[model samples]
Target: MDVDTDIDKHFQQLQDQKRMLLMAKSRKGEVPRDRKPPQVAYHQFMMSHMFRAGLAQSNENMIRSAFVPPAYQPCTTPIMKLQPIKINQLQLETHHRGRYIVLKVMTPPMRMTGILALGADANGDIVLLHMYNQEEENVREATDIVDVGMIVLVKEPYYKLTASKDYALRVDHLSDMVRLNEDDTMIPPQWMSRISEIHDSFEPHKAKADASMKKEKWWKAIRDYTAAIELGPPPDRLEIIKRNRALAYLKTKQYDAALADTGWPGFGPQPAEKALFRAAEALYHLRRFSESVAVLETLHATFPDNAQATFNLERAQKRHTEEETGCYDFKALQREAEHICPPHLDHATYIGPIKMKETAYKGRGLFVTKRVKAGDLLLCEKAFALAYVPERDEERSAGNGDITLLINIETEKGFMGGQADLIRIIAQKMYLNPSVAPAFTSLYHGDYGATPITFVDGNPVVDTFLIERTMALNVFGCPNSSLATHKRAMNNESMVDNVYHSCGIWPQASLINHSCTCSARRSFIGDMMVVRATRDLEPGDEVTFWYQIPHFKANMRDKLKGWGFVCDCALCQDAKQTKATVKKERTKLRAALTEKCNSPVPSHKAMERLIDKLEATYAVSPDLVPRLGHWDAQMQVARIYAAKGNMDQAFKSACKVLVFLGFSLDDSKKGFEIKKWGMVLDYLIDAFMFIGSALIELKALASAKKAYQYAKTVYRIVVGEDETFEKTYEDHVF
Candidate 1:
């Protein structure tokens, strides 16, 4: 949770300037309530920290990362006494331990992003409490977050001095606070006031909601319906109103709210046909396809001729099977991504042969359950929550692509704009489906440690800041892929892309560790993360993917510092052992080779000599260590030789591309055979493609066909599935 002191100083200067402006306004007898400050894109990750002091001067920080406080932990003593803790009696710089204090909000939150409220305890003693690392409160979007008149419990409240040099009780963690229903027994007699007029207006509110529904104002109808329900209507009327609200919730795409009203287990069972149908629809949208199928089956059986049920049942069955197996329609996935704002899709998640287990100093990682070959499916997982911002040519410069921002008030760092939206969406999802919280919280959040979710008033308490930290570490930058755009989009990032149009949290895939010479390769089909093995592996072999493929000149450790781990992969180890003299020699040879290849009068002999010099810098043979930089040089020389119609040298240089990558080959009369598989990369497919072309030029059709077969195996592994391999890669001959 360390922050930049400079950012903190900048925040203080901004605060002083704000006070001066407010004072000048007061002098003019025109004071503004809730005055805001200007925020610029600086010191908010991209390097600088967000700092401890408030920089949230504008309304932009509002309405993000709002979440429910955790459930109250009851005292375990056999005889517990109820005593009111006086907030006024609390002293600054003191941690008041061993007391559960009840309090009621007395004012609207004065600050946002990180919220603060002036409240009175059960003893009627008023004090200020600031919720650190939180979002806006009392917003209509998520009313359960916090609002005036809401009762809460503060555990062992720390009465401390904040950065503002003001006294307030600081609630740093969600575990330290618990929201309670107004009817809780601990609520003081003075705080037990309810409006009789509002309570009796249920009928009128329901009528207004019906009118709104007719006008197609779904959100308005939802608000009216919520107001009506909270007013305490009779059971029969309440059920009718809830059902109406459930439809509105569905229209608004609030599946969790719809499910809650669809007679979920906690709510009394409705058992009616429409209720069952609505419940199934909610489950369907939530991607609990198996549950959806079960519900739809029951409805279809009783309502035999229901066409909607029949159609949905078929779809649910297909989706459920897709989740169970890794089969998916990749073409359809691309089609969906083409839309600017696509619907929440069930590309169907399938966890294949991999199992998550703890590793040595690596912490946790995914491992293969059985011996598997390259092209074998490891996992095909849909994102838990995906935020995709279509590239708008007018908004951001082209190639910078889209960005997602997530700000952590605790750590005081900002991630990106899209990330902020994603964090809010995830918080709301967890709020709706409590079961999902455990899976989300289980992901790595570096040294932030773990905090379990607790339910309050039947609603799961989700920590928003924990989500910020977890996502900052685990979120993957997903770039859209299309067969139309690039035949082998998997290989098109020069085997590594730093730019992405979207990002998402894929829970199962996040468990895999990083390696430069990783065991598996990942490709995106819309929001679906498809992983396949890069090389053959034994049972219990760890599956790893490149977080970012390191370049020869790049400082790998510095680049991946945010990820909080140094890669100890074979390639990284080899790079470390490589001497400075070798690197200098490789650089000099690469320049000469590039000059020879790109010259108006290109010299084939000079390029070949320089390529040989580059390849020789490697301490070990190509069979043991990867000559990564040499392969590109060899490919360049091979291309020139092929154009000159010198098939002999083209074939040799083409074959050397595979050799430099640690693969041994045999082209005896027995035909083209890969004697051993070493480090595998998508570029090897290109190498074989070059080899195939060279063979065809040499009139060895049989050998060319054999080379193509090798290319197809590499293609399957690179693409992550064989379903569309032949169609996508119709021609593999260079």
Candidate 2:
């Protein structure tokens, strides 16, 4: 029953009303007068609070009797009484919505005498009184003078929805003249202050502030803006202010500031072709290629016939492409992403090798349910979704292959900064399953990749609700994930990461949660992961993968909390605990490793013992294991082999550990999977390119050539130079 509690409950009801608005289709279904319900709710909650605060029934009755104005009684019976309130001191006005106000009665013969006034109770019955503020002889004669200082007395209840108390009172026939004393007239300062405050907070004040800079009172005007801003005006008002500020900035020659303020957030009628076109021009002149491209992109979408937007977009794209190059090496890219290519696709369940769905999406391989080995043949997938982002420069690039695979075109296409239509068309093609409710409408770019599509001609129907339940059952970023990032063709900045990493459908593969140390490994059979046991797995163990960028410490992990749902799996559960007990043991091992490396006499025994202890420490809590810890330990072992002059042993350990590391979705490889034979083929291409540099470092070419030839052969097998594959290959390889 506290005022704050009352306010809070009412606020919640208001919020609920707003939320229900989205599902409402008609005006009748709309929330009934926003102000009324909350006000009533607040009043009720306040009463509850009052009762809880120990105001007993008798006490409340007495308070109500004392507080309730006498005129509020529900009755139309006429009564004669001395009018205590003056009308002259009070001014009243009404707002657009229905609410009433009246000045509290303060002195006898209050303002405006000889007025018949009515007051109403909850039932709207009127109370009437007849009185005059002045002498009866003077009141009737001064019909033309409704002076400000005069007092009027009235009897009876009146009901009306209006803010002005004085306006609700009307002068009716009192034939006798009314004599009034100036000392008896009333003027209400409180009523004037209320009107002044409301006016101060109105839109006109905002317009005044916006007009201030032109009048050269910028500082004073901006200071006045605080009140108007606190009581936020409509978007149109803000736009006008922003536009004015932009012009003011332009006059000062602060072009960038002007442009920034003039854009959508500041002064946008964004879809307006002229506004966007001009903004695009400004961005281009400023050489802000990305921003210019964005403006042009919006303009083009709004009015496709606008040649200027099209031209500007092309121009901006060209500039962007030219300026942005060498950020990544394609050969290295293949190596990094090689893990997406499994040795052989496990399609033991292939049903007649489903062909491509549409001619537009050519050579995209079909669904073949066969279990391919790590190095077995999976059907060659082509592009089922194609997007050509025209750029002025030929050097323009994309993060993934141009065409991506999909389980359902409608559901799987990501929402990123490019080619929204590409995603839209695919989403429209999704099968409508009644049971499948949408998990999220916004697509995060990281959620999908060029994963393999299962069906070509036929749509692979999936229960979206099932997917939602799966995501819920599994730990995702938010505990309640109605915002699954994969449902929409595009989302703004919010859903980018999820969509960007989204590859083809590994329906089963997607079930594995992330872990720092994963037992199961994902290798692209063709478009999907042929998930296999990288290490021996016991039955009944939950499969997991590292949800985070591996190799990061606990602090880094903490920083990424909201990126997705909080993981409550075994590994994450272990990570949440303190490592106080294990710290000492880890420190001791590290010291030993350093001491053995630095000593005048190398102690092999000491190093081996230290490594053993480190392993023991790691085994104590599998959940406590940091991703990089194991890989670093492996490297130490490899180093020991290298130092002992065991070249074969050292090389073998290095290759084994590096290969495993390469498969990791960690900071080093950025989440690009690098496992399986076909992946090795892709990796070898990079190995061939980079091995020469390493070969010179190690003074070995024979080993490097062997690695290169091995990669070349796999490429020849998996990526055959068929024209159909080649035609769609460029866009489908990322």
Candidate 3:
């Protein structure tokens, strides 16, 4: 007995240590990851240890003697047969049809994906139902995800083997599930609640609700309002009470609930101006700015001279413009980035002359509708949701700024978790403001096979698991608009390169496909992702950007392969045609030159020779295909030449750097014709700055001013905002 006790104690200590380690990880601005369980056959899951032995019997007994209400025949699925279900494949199998199933609660609800409970049909055949009220997840601290002991009429119940590896019916759409009340006449005598015991005077409850609202007790107000609503007030009084309850919901930030209340039956086809205004308020709070504008417009049509409605209409209009045009006070965004913990900006997203077009290479990609100059703003998008890990000092400075870390509940240890919290945030965003659902679900989701968002009762159902998979592909880690922060980030200062302090989804930017020779560039101003044209683009030109920079000379193809893409851009095409031995020789020379350049006493002649050899290895002309592998070496040599007081050679080398980036030179006149944009490289700014300085020394003022302006243009495009331009280059400003 002593030996057994000692062994158990040792195991317990190890488990405690593991828990501590997981807790430590969570402190680094992330929660422990949850591993999703693989799906299994319904029959197999029913026979598992979970549903076997005493558990199945215990669940069955819960509904054995208890009466259940006759469920509404809203919809029904094909009877899910008992265990040993098999698939008979056809050449073209029928899809899961829209259906519903009525079930009596047979077991206490458990939190699996959302909330799961065993439900039995009249025939005693059982299935698991998972329910979640998606929109209120972020608001109410004590919201019940799913209620137990209720007869639910589930429309279009999605039957699938869940992440828990069990076949279950998942209902997420508000319209999809009809929750039957215990007091309804349809319920059997034993199942129905006693009227006298449960009923409350409507007048008293409503009065209390109004009193609580005045005292600013939002939840108390909501509770009383709900109770009064349950008592079935007169139709005229009910409308006023519901609108009041909606105001309370808005105050508590339960936006979806507020929106639903505004849509209640009493608010019907031609609602009063007050009712319309209330609906507009809910949509505005929900971030459906465009929809809010539409509602306000309707309200204005009815009550044109109403002062309160007029002010709200203008406010909604301004927000709508911000959303459609992406115009914002960037200086404000900069200030917010400095102080805001997660840096979620309140700017509207702007999309320039770009449109999504079908492509041969990547299925679909962004393209220009009209000609755009280099540095012209293309798209500026606000993040739908951001998961940011602030520096510890920043965490404290932001005033106990607790960043919301999403922890997945299913996994035993969330060691490998990355996107769980973000996924949930995005899911909730879609659930509440489903007008943005089409935009979100249209992004690349690979072949994970999650169903499209289903609409029930005009409300969209949210599938968080689908959101998780989609977020994994589209979330971007980037720097803010501050040049100092961006420079420091590049040099491995406070935030590391591998895992940034922030990551988020910028919807419009996600449409861009990758190309080694990129035509556009993307940067961030707080949560706003700004994209600009790197080259002058004509109408119908495809816009492309690098998905990830290829810093390596070798394994570039392998890296592309890993991303499941094959680039046929000018540079990639040139690389494809080049001989392996010749490329190998160039790589060796580039490596040697890099080492020599980094040394204290370097042979300038040998460095020049290596650069000349590397540039020579490119089978295509620099004007045709920009070289990415060795631009740094050439730029470094240009700076060295200028430092050595060789202005002419430095200017030549700087011009060569331009060629390397596929920028066509127009020294024929003076400055530049803003060369054909090839690919975006890190050192282009340095190259232009050096060229401008060298031009000044060479007594070429016209060309020099042009270089300075070009440098400033690149600065705006790369750094994302212009407030820092003069500050960044104060001494060198023209």
Query: lDDT per model, in order?
Result: 0.66, 0.35, 0.63
Summing lDDT over every window of 10 consecutive residues in candidate 2, give the lowest-scoring window.
62-71
Q: Ranking under TM-score, best-scoring first?
A: 1, 3, 2
Model 3 clash tally, residue pairs: 6
Among these predictions, the greatest lDDT belongs to 1
Candidate 3 lDDT over 1-734, as tens digits, reads 00000123234434554454444334432211331232332334345426534543443322101001111122222223211111111011112345345666655554322455666554455666666434323354322334446676565455543333334565643445655544544344544543343445688889988998898878778877888898899988898888899888778656777878887324677786767887888888766788888888888998998888889888878778877776766677777877775677655677789999889868778999998988888988887776554533444344332222222232221211123335555766776566666677777558766554365444566665556556656767665444546566446576433344456777788888877677888877777788888888999888887666655364556655635678776666777788989878877987898898899977668788887888788777876776666677777777788789998888887787787777777753255546566555655666677788888888888888888878777877777766676776676644
Ranked candidates (lDDT, high to low): 1, 3, 2
Give residue 228's error in model 3 in angstroms: 4.1
List where candidate 3 sits over 4 angstroms from the true fold: 1-138, 143-197, 208-232, 251-277, 285-315, 323-326, 391-418, 444-460, 480-485, 489-495, 499-501, 561-563, 667-669, 731-733
State the lDDT of candidate 2 residue by residue for 585-635, as single tens digits. 666667667777677766546665665676576543332343233444445
Clashes of each: 12, 108, 6
Candidate 2 error regions (>4 Å) = 1-415, 418-423, 431-549, 552-616, 621-627, 633-734
